[model samples]
Target: MKFATAAAMLAAVLGSPVAAQNFTSAAEVRPILDMTRGSWVAIREYGGKDLVYFTHLLAWRCGLREIRYGFNGAAPNTPFKMEQCHDGAAQPNAISGDGVFVSQPGGSVKEVRVKLIYDDGTTDEARFTRDQILMR
Candidate 1:
């Protein structure tokens, strides 16, 4: 079968709305690259003891290495870290992890600082408010 035919068959069985597209030039991947250049903040980390809830850092596949995040002024260091990798292919963003930032009953989350480190040794930093994060 052809590539498109196989993709259609897979999408039909899996009910996947995400479709694939081919671009002629590499510049077409810029918009996707830009979207993944930000930080994913912690939205909700409640209702569970051993689980944590965070936002999606990257939407499209990229060579993202890891995401470093922590509270604003908690301590000397934040041990929370999220790792990203691609198995001979581009990898997605952090969808699940341990307790990176635990939500409290009365804790008012002010700002979350996040850093995105790519595989090319380049990094980007961005700050996100509570409303900026999305629930998984």
Candidate 2:
């Protein structure tokens, strides 16, 4: 199916009005390169809970053509992963993704790096800090 048509269907499913031609480029995957150049890790540890929270940070501005992201966990990490991403055009500004990190003994997450590549050939990066991740 064509991307434009798929996007329209997605918009309908999301219950939001997505402008036509929002995603100009084809849904074709781009090449992977130096992700470290424009990316930061977003992770936080909470005591001996044996769980670490990690996520991908997106800018408030919409118009993102594509997004390429990956994760790098700190030491003592375990494999208890649950990941999700939000890149809906209907809510472009709210684009984001997050997952769980399990650590042994300490239950700490040192960091989670994220890189976002927009449709306009631009990039944005962010790392989640303890203060920002803590719930009120």
Candidate 3:
């Protein structure tokens, strides 16, 4: 208990930065992410593993420095891996794009969101509420 108390007190003294990130539209994000498009899929295992929904994209853009998944607007500096893509420069990008806030098959009680930060100091945030993946 002493250790826990000490940790808590130390944390209180050294306050952490707010995890808030700017939420933006897909069009603004796509250009920065270098992605043609992006969407939120709940439990839709791409590589396997049933976590929460993931923010997937079409034609992953290069120079994607970081991707952060935040629940209810808190961007907890979690580690994430962007999908590997090859030679995506040839593909065209979208300016006015649209996506549905799909309530995936298994619904989540809280809202979900993702932030994409590029190597050029650009950041975009997409918000969604998780739904269960429609398993086949």
Candidate 4:
């Protein structure tokens, strides 16, 4: 019982940063557009496993020197990769643009770490655990 309690406490401490990620909530991202909706509006899973959808263009316009991500517990070193962002004009069902960032890792992905490095010496980051990715 004591060991279990201690382990739970440690898990809570380690998971706290995930709660502080810059990921915009679904409620907060909904007001950005009156008629259009897309994955960029919030953090989400796309396609299948090892893939996550998020936004990097709303607040800072992604005006950063570099954006990188890594899988599991590895240090973030992979360059950011995302599809082009377009409005709902062309495809009413889907919207794309810089307003979103999608990472499609090549293999089984249990966790993801993303780091956004801005030119102003500031950074925004997030990590998606497997449970969070699948549950959401």
RMSD, one per candidate, in order: 8.9, 11.5, 15.9, 13.3
* Local accuracy by lDDT, each model: 0.46, 0.38, 0.43, 0.46
User: Which regions of candidate 4 deviate over 4 angstroms?
Assistant: 1-49, 56-59, 82-107
The 10-residue segment with the lowest total lDDT in model 3: 16-25
- Screening candidate 1 with a backbone cut-off below 3 angstroms (N, C-alpha, C), the clashing residue pairs are none
Query: What is the lDDT for 25 in model 4?
Result: 31
Residues 101-133 of candidate 4 have per-residue lDDT tens digits of 455543466777766555455655666666655
Q: How far out, in Å, is residue 18 in model 1?
A: 11
lDDT of 2 by residue, 15-43 (tens): 55555423323222111122223222233
Best-to-worst TM-score order: 1, 4, 3, 2
Q: List the residue pairs that clash in candidate 4.
A: 85-96, 85-97, 86-96, 86-97
* Candidate 1 to truth, TM: 0.48
Q: Candidate 4 has what TM-score?
A: 0.42
Among residues 3 or more apart in sequence or in different chains, the pairs in candidate 2 whose N, CA or C atoms overlap within 3 Å are 40-113, 40-114, 41-112, 41-113, 42-112, 42-128, 65-119
Ranking by lDDT: 4, 1, 3, 2
Name the candidate, 1 or 2, with the larger lDDT value: 1
